[model samples]
Target: MRTFLTLFIALTLGLGWGLAARAEGFLGVYEDLPLAPGLTEVEGSGLSFDSPGGRIVEGYATGAVEAAEILKFYAATLPQLGWARDSDTLYRREAEVLKIDTEVDGGALAVHFTISPE
Candidate 1:
């Protein structure tokens, strides 16, 4: 009984931690937004606000990965999160729009993400 209790507690804690980590967003910018793998958030580049209209957010991330890979990641991931692709780099969900843009920076790709009221 003692061994079973300890195992149960450990499993519960481990599951909670795993869920929290999975739900965390890039740079802590937006709670519901997902970050692409192999990218790191740009320091001091996140912006977020809530106005009467709605919420707005912007942030940047950089990675050594190819632009196509990043695009593919979002393309496959965003729709599952309720965002419908509006274009190659734009997505929409309910009352907001999410746009993704990338630029080559010193052999790395700099990704700019913006969320605004639709």
Candidate 2:
């Protein structure tokens, strides 16, 4: 029983730390944007500082969250982060484009987000 308790505690703490570390990578321009609840960053699904002109981030997140909620969340939040919304796309005042699309992929939702300067 004591051994089981120790293992459980270690697993719990390790999981929390892993989540935090995963979130820490999305700093700078991505600071205002947030990952959907219960979603973790997919490996090799992100690109940062790719060029002098743009950056791209794309990946799938597995969660029970609804697609509409994810869209609504960004629709409302991006403007607050200084990205102007025009229909389904967002644009920065400096001509950067933030495109987002989501669809059901297997048991998870595939999220594609790309931002590029025009």
Candidate 3:
């Protein structure tokens, strides 16, 4: 099953470092994406979402691009639809790395995420 995929930068900038970075649990076709504020996963398109979590566009990888670049893309596409940033959660571990969970106002399309080094 495809899981939340990370759009990495070590690979996006064409660094060719071949670092130990890898993409795992990258899922597509998110279903029942919550579009409301209180509820969750009501209705979603198998293709595009212009609501809250709807900002999550496919055909992109975090492990393949810089964080700044990924942010830029989201910034450009999200605001165009007036999707508001409800909250951004950060997950971290002891002596480990930091992971980020981005929440939006796509109603029930609640897309939660966190990333760590591999």
lDDT of each: 0.76, 0.55, 0.29
lDDT digits (tens) for residues 1-118 of candidate 2: 4365335434534676333222322323344445655455565656656666665544444455677766766666556445688765455635567777777778777666667776
Number of clashing residue pairs, candidate 2? 0
**Candidate 1, 1-118: lDDT as tens digits:** 4365335434534676432233224446775566777688887889999989999999899989899988877887667566899887999988999999999999999999999998
Give the residue spans of candidate 3 off by over 4 A. Answer: 1-27, 31-61, 86-118
The prediction achieving the highest lDDT against the true structure is 1
lDDT tens digits by residue: candidate 3, 73-95: 33333232223333323322222
Q: What alpha-carbon RMSD in Å does predicted model 1 have with respect to the real structure?
A: 8.7
lDDT of 1: 0.76
In model 2, which regions exceed 4 Å deviation? 1-29, 50-60
Error of 1 at 111 (Å): 0.3
Candidates ranked, most accurate by lDDT first: 1, 2, 3
Candidate ranking (TM-score, best to worst):
1, 2, 3
Where does the lowest 10-residue lDDT sum fall in candidate 2? 19-28
Q: Which predicted model would earn the best TM-score?
A: 1
